[model samples]
Target: MVTTTGVLFIVAAVVLFFFWIYGIVSFYFDLRYRFLPAVREHLRDDEQQARPDPEEYL
Candidate 1:
């Protein structure tokens, strides 16, 4: 019984590890392919619109 339990625990651990690795990899690829460009474009637009003009401030 103890051996069976140990084996089951190990199997569960490995399965969870695989899923964790898969999630991390998928997240990274999704961010790189789908999200980064949009984020960068948003930031660029915000920066362009938010620039401070000294004359305006004066």
Candidate 2:
């Protein structure tokens, strides 16, 4: 006694939920593996450049 619209809605909900989970897992791994390293590298470069010379009148 189920309608076609109900079945379609259920299917769509399941598909969307799977996609949501996939996005979360992908984002976590990407941020951990790629983003953190890149950010660290960028920060290191910043630290290496434009540094003030040490005061000689200490």
Task: Give the residue spans of candidate 2 off by over 4 A.
Answer: 48-58
Instruction: Report the alpha-carbon TM-score of model 1 versus the true structure.
Output: 0.65
**Which pairs, if any, clash in model 1?**
none
lDDT of 2 by residue, 1-58 (tens): 9999999999999999999999999999999999999999999989977686578456
lDDT of 1 by residue, 31-53 (tens): 99899999999999999889987
Task: Output the worst ten-in-a-row residue range by lDDT, candidate 2.
Answer: 49-58
